[model samples]
Target: MIEVEHLSKRYGSAPAIKDVTFSVEKGEILGFLGPNGAGKTTTMRILTGYLPATSGTARIAGFDVHEDSMAVRKHIGYLPETPPLYPDMTVEGFLHFVARIKGVAAGDRANRVQSAIQRCNLQERRQTLIRKLSKGFRQRVGIAQAIVHDPPAIILDEPTVGLDPRQIIEVRNLIKSLAGEHTIILSTHILPEVSMTCNRVAIINRGEVVATNTPEELLQQLTEGTGYELEVEGNIVNLTTYLQRLAGVRGVEQLSNQYLPEHRHKLRISLEPGQDLGRNIAAIVVKSGLGLYEMRRVQASLEDVFLELTTEEKPIDAEKTIHTEPAVDSASPASDSVVEAAQTTPTTSPTLVPESTHPSGGEDA
Candidate 1:
């Protein structure tokens, strides 16, 4: 359970996060997303009690982050973007050291350290010096340290930043496996990661949370209505111009990459969101002597939401589904429950996420 109320942070005249408020419920994974310098890490550090906000407050497990930082720290595990590794120490020794610092009982420290090493797939590297290990192993060591005390919640800052594809998946899978027993918050810039690993996402932009909602909700809210994507095989020039002229239509933007440089007869058209212009556009294209290859509504996606919420004054269709919470949510206020769950559980799986909760793929409970 976590609550961040009107959180703001500043370095002199420059602010990092401003008027940001959100919560994560027990057992849910809240994906923190943003571009570099978007204040993602700043918010995370505040939540984990690693950094104090210039103004505003954060609470962990019902304990105020600033007033009860020590108590809050006892309930949460934190791993920064760069793995904080002691190059001189072996993996086991480093983990042992972290366990003591985290206040793990001396009697159970060895077992807890071993369990962390095992769960993070660091068994083979347990005796190796942290500095000598590969980047991936070093990351695992960082994770091991975070979990050595078995805190109820884990906050991971850019967990996959420098890993290769395979290692990225490995780390993601490991995070996923900790569901139900350990609440986790994973921050990353990759949009697909939020869709794939989190139950909900909060996008921070320009030092403020420009948007906060499940991926799908944000997309729906951003879009004014439904739209279509078209691919034509011939005469795109006249056809595209014709489609732009139809009534109830907003505009048309062409986005295409020929399969090969030698290919030039095909075009991909993204219809601006508005009324039912697909049929009219279709008629015009066929009449123009161009063979239509494919025409279908482009459902709202995470990218749509990101673009719409981050920028202003872009026209959009109104038919998009942005009215209600995803069907899977069984909680009253989404922020409250999701935030609470973030302490004790990491969500079930890809399918368990609340329905209509994401831009495209579904999340598991």
Candidate 2:
């Protein structure tokens, strides 16, 4: 568990993190998301005791990060943006050294080192020098070193950044397997990674936490009355035009690629958030005599939430037409409250809403 209160960090004159506060729950995977220079790495550094905060307080499992840094470090395993490694050392040698420095008991050091190697699947490369290993192997080496001591929490900063797709998947599965046994804070800009690995996410923009909740809660917060995509065999007697006139129907997109020539129109319909447009849209297609091939809800994802939070409010694109049936009277604000944080200070992120927070559009329900 972790807690930050009124945390801020300044570099000379400008702040890198400011008045940022949040908690990382036990056994939960918390995704730390933000654009470049979002202070994600900076915050992690402070929590890991790699860097000291400019102001405020931070606590790890009830130990003050500033006062009891060594105690805090004893319970946290951190893999930074780059894994610290010795190019000439073999995997087994490196892990053994890490276990010693982390204070593993002399009698248990061999078991601890072996456990890390097995968990990271480095058996084949145990004798290979780190500099001679592949990028994926190097990443695994970093992770193995971090976990060699079996710390209670793991901080992986961009663990999949340079890996190929398959390598990324491997690391992802590895991280997922570590959860429940180790609390993790996975920091990355890749939305798909968070969706796959984390239970909860905190969208950090301009150095502040703009949004925080379970991945599903965050998606559901933006999906109410979003849209539906339907692929069908027929335009069928003007059904598309008629569906446009139905209540809560905002807009329709017709896909016109050469790949689908049989009946040709694939409709992507936008509707009032929270409205049941699928059943209504289906009825129109049936009544108009069109053959429906596939229909499903198009939920707004984590990317949509990140952009909406990080990007400042701007004028709508002029070429795009705005369509809407009506605003749902059931709309609710984004979160529970904006209470004063009780922990450490952090630097501010560059791209975000103004200092005075604005109400978010959808309800989590």
Candidate 3:
């Protein structure tokens, strides 16, 4: 429901975002990821009409963000990095004011305000002044305001920042629930947020989009530093040396030697991406007379793609070298679904290859 083409923004001689482009599908939660100074907030501001782009076209639900500014604003709800809240206003009063400003019908204003308050779990604090609420509660109030009008799309910048773990989970669940009803462009640096909450992700770096795809598809793009972890019961002191010498094996690092019985050891095995080393490693362990208690294939994650994309010094062209992986065998679930995105050992860090445009757009510094 969003589109951006060749979007760019500059301040003085330096560019904040250059040729930034990306799109978000209807009813999708797209994580807009980038490091500091990578222009994420700049892009969001432009799309929300708070800032203008130097040059480019941005459309929201077919409405031109620039030419149809009012129309676009009507269809979108935006929460800036720092929530704009009236500390003196009570929660109910604030939401009622927001509903009016967002143009909710007079007859429906009460319902909309109540729905927002309920959805954000602000019932207990609806009578409390915003200034009296904790940071987490205030954040919920900000989100409640954004959705009070029930817009078609929502642009959230760091929705979970400053929240405690419990608060973060509450907000995360709330965001997930909003999908299908409201298209969301979630801009944040928290990798796990993208992995757990978003259907797809866009990584921007050096004022440009470097990658865009589903989290799983992007993880498959890693060409190195993919492998497994093993817990074995053995006494071999030279296992690391042997594993390293094996074909396709990149490196072996012993993580721990602790065991009550003193026969078990845990080690991490690094391999080239897409390498089928599981059977070989298992066989080697058997031949070495070690009991393989567990072996779980490591999977790449959004963080891996983010670090690879943003850490690079050069700009990446999203049009080329970014494609989804073909059908491949899925890794067996031997461990938690949480991907350990540790840097690949003994291999060059993987490079991010972007494919589609994510409509992050652009804005001035």
> Every model's Cα RMSD, please?
14.6, 13.1, 11.0
Off by over 4 Å in 2: 230-245, 250-267, 285-296, 313-319, 322-365
Measured against the true structure, the TM-scores of the candidates, in listed sequence, are: 0.76, 0.78, 0.77
Query: Lowest-lDDT window of 10 residues in candidate 1?
Result: 350-359
> Candidate 2's C-alpha lDDT?
0.77
> Per-residue alpha-carbon lDDT of model 3 for 1-365, expressed as tens digits?
99989999877667888998899999999999887678888889999998888999999999999999999999999998889999999999999999998899999999999999999999999999999999889899999999999998999999999999999999999999999999999998899999999999988887889888898888777434477778888764544444555767777766645442577877777776556666666766665567888888776666667777777554443222212231222342311111111112233434322111334333323
lDDT tens string, model 2, 160-272? Answer: 99899999999999999999999999999898999999988988887788888988777667433377777777533255556565666777756543577766556677776
Error of 2 at 177 (Å): 1.2
Tens digit per residue, CA lDDT, model 1, 105-217: 99999999989989999888888987799888888888888888988888998888789998888888888877667878888888777887887888888778877777766
Q: After superposition, how far is residue 181 of candidate 3 from its true place, in Å?
A: 0.9
Clashes of 2: 25
Model 3 stretches astray by more than 4 angstroms = 230-268, 272-276, 286-296, 313-365
For each candidate, what is the lDDT? 0.71, 0.77, 0.79
Q: Cα lDDT for residue 351, model 3?
A: 32
Best by lDDT: 3
Over the full model, what C-alpha lDDT does candidate 3 score relative to the true structure? Answer: 0.79
